[model samples]
Target chain A: MSTLRTEEMTLNMGPQHPSTHGVLRFIVRADGEVMREAIPDVGYLHRSIEKIAEKVGYHGFMPYTDRVDYVCAMFTNQGWGMASEKLANIQVPKRGEYCRAIATEFNRLASHLLSVGTMGMDIGAMTPFTHAIREREMINDLIEELCGARLTFNYMRIGGVAWDLPPGWREKALAYLDHFEPILDEYNALISYNKIYIERLANVGIISADEAVNYNLVGPNLRGSGIKWDIRKDLPYSVYSEFDFDVPVGKGEWGKLGDAMDRYMVRIRELKESVKILRQALKQIPAGPVLAKVPRNFKPPAGECQIRVESARGDMGWYAVSDGTGYPWRVHVRTGSFAAMGIIQKLSQGLMIADLVTLIASLDVIAPEIDR
Target chain B: MEAARIYQRIKDRFGEHVLEISDHQPDPFIVIDPASIEEVGSFMRSDPELALDCLSNESGVDYKDRIEVVYHLFSYSKRHGAVLKVKLPRENPTVATLENIWKSANWMEREIFDLLGVIFEGHSDLRRILMPEDWPGFPLRKDFVEPTEYHGISTVRESPIIRLDPKKK
Candidate 1:
């Protein structure tokens, strides 16, 4: 008699799994509860964005950027606008810079809220996720009032914002900030201290500073591994340097483990710093022309340039090569999510199958950002 | 370190391999030869003064005569950036891979390969990333000709064609 040996069972985790978020699929070869190999299959949400940029004019391409990283739409808008401004040699007005700073910081808060909150849900803690998203909805309401849409708001224009702050916008935003702090405290108390959550994330995905640098990881992922690098502080493009805020590095924050838990804590600290930036921006903003005086049909000279901005995810870069025309010859978005996904392939190699979702959530891999 | 200082160091280090160093409005770029890319790249990454630890981006631009491969490297420790360019002949465009230095270069090189058809000499899995497996010529190249006939479907050509009729006018 001969016994048949079976290979590891292959399972598909999603092109539509709720935890996988945004059209992402994982081909997992597992033995019982242990994952042997996890192959990430992308391109489901591919919009051929680079090719599309070749067709659209400079300013017309702004709207498409909002869809690239929907969670942090303002950063996407700011990155594209900054690249265009650099190419055209146009200066943004003081008022426009202040407004862009505020909008981008607000979007940062929203992106981190979803990242940390959904992270809790993935780790089997349900209440914190509900509480965190409830706060995010309030911010979404403000974004909707600013732009017509709740999500994918094409609000940032090339030279400035689409429009100035509406009536009572600052007061309402301040009220939301005041309301959000206590809830964040509650989240820290609820999930950050939970033993089960701590065990799963404490040292699970520990990427050292050397490995993080080698992989070119950015944002909280890099910081979490004890690298004191934040694009906002290191290479400030807009009015970020003028503001007073801490670039939270996660070396000794939570135990000695620079792992997934450290990344989660760094995000929480960044949220507080973002709030501080918003407060200073709201106080010192001078009233003047919100839009810069740019030509109706703007055309930059034939040249190639690259601009990098610190988004909520990480270093969001836009490389535009112009051909002395209204449209760009080529545009490439170096998205942070796409960079972070590279690390996951290495980190998930030895982990259990159950821990995979938690690891994915911790990385905050937005699929459109990856697919685009 | 400032952009000017880095430009000077790059010029001093790789004398002739450095094609042109310019302090443009946005950033500074050093254009170099495609053959010595790996040596120059290793120096940029490991040199204590120019610690470009992070490979920010890798992309390809297709000019009419040649294909240009661009590498954007940023040093977080020193808070400086430099763009490195390498040009290759369009006929058989090839460059050494930097995957051994920075792991993230893996995907970006694949992207360049898929779009511009530039072959990386030592890439582990050099395949089309964004495009389909059995796709035609690279779409981003200037000389890329769209298929006029594929799978028995003939696309209508815009050029005028001479006709011979049974009854001449």
Candidate 2:
């Protein structure tokens, strides 16, 4: 008997596919139905914001940071603010810190909602996505109230914030939080624990805890692997230490630890944690001026420092080098998605072609964050 | 596990491979010889007491005559972190790849190579990450000139606002 000859076939996922998150292309080599390898081809959305940082002055570059991760612009805003503050040796007042924390926590929730909803959609469920967007709409309104814009919220400054909370915005945000808490359960009931959803996600794209550490996985993806490491808790910055909240790690809930389901579950758990932090920030927020009296010609000392913030995605770090001039010498945004994109190709091998979508959703590798 | 003590341990262990320590900054960094960076990196990851498991961030900065590749390492088990700097001449700044030591360094080193033109020896896939393959001069270099065109398309943005400006000289 003679065996049939077979060859590995190449497939391009997309720089335009809706499911691949943003503009990202994956050149996947497949052996029949199983993926032999998937080489990621990025740089489609490379804005070269780092180069722009050198050209633009410190204060002027805050808007550019917004585009770094539009889904979680607040985190990048905070990251840039914290980095510049450290570079300039400026301290934000307690109230200012609280305000920043409150805004950031809310942004985290908004981002996670999108991720959770979209992950549901990616795996074939659609109702949960709309449910998530409904709740997220309220959060966006509150965020827009805090910052002038909703998506690219350039709300943070070198020392503090761009604006104080609008009148009764705290009351409105608190009400939204109260209304939003039970929506999680409703959404879970709707699709999270659906048999099909579990079957689709569970035991697929399993990354060991050690592999997660090796790959420098961050955010829910790392926590889903049962690592129990969060920059907010482990390396606390801002007033994160002041507030008490649990860092939820994957405990092999539905399948093996660090499976696609575990990653999804971690995001669900984080939504509650983010709310807890927001509550503390809002209640303890003291009344004071929001923006610090930064100099017009914003020149930081000639030094470099690494500032990391627990963004919705992961440890969003900004490494800035200043040259005692208005312009930054060098700025590098170390995004969580960048590493995720690199590691995806290795993880995609030997898996079914369809599981690739599940893996991308679970990892939450948004294209702007990776490309920027 | 303070920065000073970590610096001392690495210096003692590696001897001359540990070139110098810059302790002035809040996050002190120890400069490592380019030749021994790969060895030092592997040791840093395996050493139980100093298990720098995660490569937090790897960035490159071009400083006219020299290009500095900075590696910020964080140990999850130890809960301590350290920074290592490997400086090289502006021309052909090639350092051994950390991709073997930390899987996270794969894309990061590619990024540094793309922007700053620092060649990482033994990098499994050392290619442009955020820039096109045949793109001219490294954009991050202080002396890099912006391309006039990319694939026959004008890279210049002839701004309508600038053209409409009455204050134009």
Clashes of 2: 0
Off by over 4 Å in 2: A1-3, B162-169
Candidate 2 reference-contact recovery: 0.78
Candidate 1 segments whose C-alpha is farther than 4 A from its true place: A1-6, A252-256, B142-169
Model 1 clash pairs?
Answer: none
Q: What is the TM-score of chain A alone in each candidate?
A: 0.96, 0.98
Give the best candidate by DockQ: 2
Best candidate, TM-score-wise?
2
Global Cα lDDT for candidate 2: 0.90
lDDT of 2 at A207: 91
Model 1 lDDT, full chain set:
0.85
